[model samples]
Target: MSRYDPSAFPPFAVTVDLVVLTVREHALCALVVRRGEPPFQGYWALPGGFVRPDEGLAEAAARELAEETGLRAHTAHGQAAAGAHLEQLATYGHPQRDPRLRVVSVAHLALAPDLPTPRPGGDARSARWAPVGELLGRGGEDGVPLAFDHAAILADGVERARSKIEYSSLATAFCPAEFTVGELRRVYESVWGVVLDPRNFHRKVTGTPGFLVPSGGTTTRQGGRPAQLFRAGGATVLNPPMLRPEP
Candidate 1:
């Protein structure tokens, strides 16, 4: 083999963008921030930042998440004040995606229960959660276009959440530790943008083994009548899977 030449390859930088999602007021919302600098300055975009040299991809993702929204990362095994389920989403490396440099973004998706209002951090001018419907509007008709290729990134993350819940128990990540069947159903509705038959949804979820365990309690939080509460069980993937309706 011949000697390798460092000059032969172009220099590039890596970044971590986050699609932090939650269900608020029966709507599926994503965290967004206003850019304070040029290259889409002042445009609303997904929360992200350049990866630091000392950190790995996951570490960089977690760091950026906290810096942008004050949210601490959590897996299925732990909890925090505003804990979220974090996982690698996808990578975007279009040659001209960034004008300033050759940049590759490794995006991650985070799902959490309804969160408190976010505080702007890092290079963000302001931060808040906006409904996915409003953000993913058509041709700038329903909503304003996001900065960079963030609109595509947000769409991918939204689809991932919508589809993951159909075959896995991951939807529970958007619910509190203890939640009612009605509350869980609403989570599905918000993510999928479709209404489900309440009785059918209740039966399907309860019948799925290891999907939920009764907390042996009841609440009238939603009003009308008391509903039994349950917590997410040990099952990660559903056996037969909860199929999505034809759209």
Candidate 2:
């Protein structure tokens, strides 16, 4: 036998976990699946799976997203489809995270304007969207314990979304292709969970150079007078970023 040896340690498996977020009935919600196997079977958890050797990290994230949620990644930007966005959230490699083996999970975050519904796939038993605030708290109404360390990962994704909105045009990812300033402000309010003075919000958004571009159009009110329409501008980051209240 040869002297060379390469089996000193156990093999590590890589996984992709997704924090799928959307605004539902004025509340920020996340998609969760009920585990179908051991190690937390029947408990709520994020959608995820083992990565194929042929795929890259992001490709694995996209494949898992499509398999679980029926949403596809955008071909142009390498994010989720238009009006939706996806990006790497963080990586979790804690030993014992997966009792089955040594697993390292690279988590991803996805934002959608709104979705029709979500159905579970792969190893999930059931899937549904739940409010973020409720999932984070314990003993509160609608509060349910999540499986594994998913609660902590979900919390991190929410904070990332909130902070990203302040500087990046990412808030627009929560809106349609075209929307009014009032609508855009609503996105911020819903995610931030704090009321913003309408006048101030309008001023801040408008004054920020290249933050929004007027579509030169208006729409009749759902109840009141007509409102002007606008679309997302070219700028990605807001220099002198808009500030949110302390949490």
Candidate 3:
């Protein structure tokens, strides 16, 4: 044991940026807020800020998520948490990512059921949930870009969502407390950006034991005959996995 360290490590700041995602209008949308101040004032970016010394990474992330989306943190179970499904997405420390200082961002990923429009928080000028393609300049936004390396962080989060739902019951995080199979299928279709065969999707999902529990009810919300309603089950990691169809 040696105590020969005096400021051995260079000064750096930690921040928590969120890639809050939801499926709306049959499209995958990410929560973005317009920066109200400089560096990239007026430019839309992920909702995040420096972590306070007293807060843990998850607490800070959940706080930011609540402030930006007006949805508080609430997870009764790993799959069907009453609130948004949250997890660590990735970390970005490219040195020049943040212009202000040597900053490192521990990014968090959130998968929420359809949510209301986001409200501006912190120094944000405005906030809204925009289609991921638009935010990435793929939906004809006139080449607009996110403030920092946020774009990459968001991309990683999207990929994680697309993949996680395959082997984990995480997709239910995008569904209501009690939802129809079609609703869950739509989540897959939107996030994967591919149309899924209704029959096959239903077979795979329902066939997976401990994935969805019957809610003892049915509804005709999706049209046609009444469809049974179900809730996320206790199982988190879905056995056999729901693989995406090849392109």
Kindly list the per-residue Cα lDDT of model 3 for residues 44-138, writing each as its tens digit: 78898889999888888877867765666643343224656888878899989988989999998888899887777678878888888787766
Cα displacement (angstroms), candidate 3, residue 137, comes to 4.1
Q: Can you give the TM-score per candidate against the true fold?
A: 0.94, 0.92, 0.92
Clashes of each: 0, 0, 0
* Model 1 misplaced regions, further than 4 Å: 74-83, 138-143
The deviation in Å at residue 18 for candidate 3 is 0.2
Alpha-carbon lDDT of model 2: 0.84
Tens-digit per-residue lDDT, 32-70, candidate 1:
988889888888889999999998888888888789777
Q: Which RMSD values do the candidates have, in order? A: 2.0, 2.5, 2.2
Pick by TM-score: which candidate is best?
1
TM-score of 1: 0.94
After superposition on all CA atoms, how large is the RMSD of candidate 3? 2.2
Q: Which scores higher on TM-score, 1 or 3?
A: 1
